[model samples]
Target: MATWLTTFSYWLLIQSFVITIILLPLSHLLVSYLPLYLFNYRSHDSPSRYLLFITLFIPFTIIFLLITDLSHIVILLFFVWFSVLLGFIDHQTGYLPDLLVYPLLVLALLFHAMQSNEQLLLAIYGALVSYLIFWFIYGFFKLAIKRRGLAQGDIKLVAAYGAWLGVYILPYLMLLSACLGLLNYILLWIKIRYKPDKIAFGPALASAGIGLMLIKYFKEDWLIKIIL
Candidate 1:
């Protein structure tokens, strides 16, 4: 069984890599134009070349990590792809479209259901828990700071992540996201010599999600041990 899983994992890694390279350019184009079509406003001034590099880099990295285990490859890939998409969109426009996020949530739920009813319940609980946590944070920011701290899209993005990764991973995800976000802020500040008024949270969260998935892929036994 382990040998079969290893063989299948290698095959999936190769297949997913090829597919990612083929689809990435198209994904970039879609990310570029879709918002314009839907909102009649260009989400970004122009797509950054660096964005293209990061976009291609993440899935390749994730697929490489998954080559040792295929247990969650399909769902993980789906989550990675959409997370990348939504991250790009949110970074550019400060919006996470329902068109992408809703489908991701549905896919997570369906995939979890395929595994077991218990998993499906956990996914649902994860979604609600994460959403409520973010919602509370958002409300607190509004009341305390007299400004929106987290956007609705960000809340939904976290909820989608919870649906896919489950409640157990939420604390790690949040911590990673906060750390990455701070790092991003520092880099941007260093580059521009001023703090940017707005920082995008989606990229950090997406990155954290990918990191967690990689951990699950490569250290499933360790994770299980820790959880148990």
Candidate 2:
């Protein structure tokens, strides 16, 4: 058992390194070109390639080491990859392309569908309910603040999280994301000495979604205690 575990860990390390090398340039190209394709203009919001590589590598390695189930690892890694890419795009350009998000939503539903009927139902409910709730909030904030409080893309992103993680995680996801957003706002204020006009919230959503998924799967009592 020990030998098998050692071999598995070694191979995982090599595979993750190779995958990160391949994904780094690919990620760079996507972030650089996707904006031009979608909006007919280039964006300067692309994060540093080195930073992107590190971000991908760390998660890839950590997930590979933690998840023993091959199927779950594949699906979770794909989801994380998408989350990172979407987060970066939204962070840089303040836009979330439907091209990426719609596909992710469909994939999440399909994944749940394969699990069982009950799980599929939960995923569907999650998506629909989250969309409606966010839509109402968006409208209310737009009316109250005289400006759009959340983007349509953000609503879709939240719905995607519901579909991926299930309905039970929605409240925790929202709370964590809200806390992260406030921290982001405060940090930016301190750095710039004023409130910024906009915050790219998709990153916060993506991060919270990933964190909640980890907590859900690992069943870490101490982690859950800290989070809740």
Candidate 3:
């Protein structure tokens, strides 16, 4: 029985890896085409060249994530689609647009509703709670501390995560993001001749979102349960 299971798993992994490799060229095309398609980035020739290199690194990530199930693959598809869109937007302009966020919100709501009552509620609650928490924090900090440290983009990005991950998971995600973000900030300070404001929080938010998504799918409950 163990031998059979091992053989089946190996076969599945090979098939999925093959499919992902075949898709790499297509992903390359998307990375290149995304800049031109996004209107604002049609003029920039260099970033697309770099993005193609980034696309090449994407396959291993795809294969690693695919080791789990089809649902995760679908989630990754959506995540990649959104990430590409945002990447283009960020590359062209200095902002992550509301245009993508609105559509994502609609799609997420529709997707959850189609799934079931529990999912719909969880998604909605996640979005609402995350948004409000961030919003209040931003406002309070802005008033009392007299500083605008956290960007609204970060708030909306976390709100978007609400549609995908569990409500409880959002807090953990935020905590993880804070820790990692600080580490990244310090690394950037030491390595790059750039300031903190030069590096946008949107990328950090994207990384955090990806990290949470990966942990939710790949990490076993016992790992989190024991840690928590």
Candidate 4:
């Protein structure tokens, strides 16, 4: 099994390079037009260059495949692809367009369905519960502060994550994302020496969700072995 896994890992790595090359141009186009068409948001004149973008995800894709099962590669790929795109868009424009988030939720439900009816049910419950919880937080915070504490897009994104990860993981997802956001806030404050009116939460949420998946699907101690 170890020998087969090692061989398969190498094969997958090569395939990932080919896949990333194909995905790069298409992803660039999607990022460029999707927001323009769907949300009337302007695309950046100078988006991150292709080389830099590829550099960001290549290591993540490698670690993702090394730990992921062959059976899950397709759905997980979509999850990562959509989440990364959403993260990038939000970071760039401060908008998580429904065009992306809704499809993300639907795909996650379909992915859960492929596992079992029970899993699908859990995903539904997870989505509903997560949405309500975040919605409440948004409402309460807004009432207290006379400003929107969380964007509607971020609330929906959290619900989509619950759909993907199931209800059992919602607390961990929220806690980790909060910690990440707080850390980001601290760094931004140090850099600018004042409280910024707003900071992007989408990136932190996306990173936390992916981080939880790595923990959930950890395959042996392969990463540790490589580090040593």
Worst 10 residues of 3 by lDDT: 1-10
lDDT to native, each model:
0.78, 0.83, 0.62, 0.79
Among residues 3 or more apart in sequence or in different chains, the pairs in candidate 2 whose N, CA or C atoms overlap within 3 Å are: none
Clashing pairs in 1: none
lDDT (Cα, 0-100) at 25 in candidate 2: 86
Predicted model with the maximum TM-score: 2
What is candidate 1's CA lDDT for residue 81? Answer: 79
lDDT of 2 by residue, 1-228 (tens): 112244467788888888889888888888788878897767755668987887778778767766777777777778778888898888878899898888778878877887899989999999998899899999999999888889999999999999987888889888999998888888989999999998989889988988877677655555465765
Error of 2 at 183 (Å): 1.5
Compose the digit string of candidate 3's lDDT tens values, residues 43-91. Answer: 4453454553354335335434344545545545566456555544554
Winner by lDDT: 2
lDDT value for candidate 4?
Answer: 0.79
User: By TM-score, how accurate is candidate 3?
Assistant: 0.69
**Which of the two, 1 or 3, has more TM-score?**
1
Please provide the root mean square deviation of candidate 4 (C-alpha atoms, Å): 3.8
Clashing pairs in 3: none
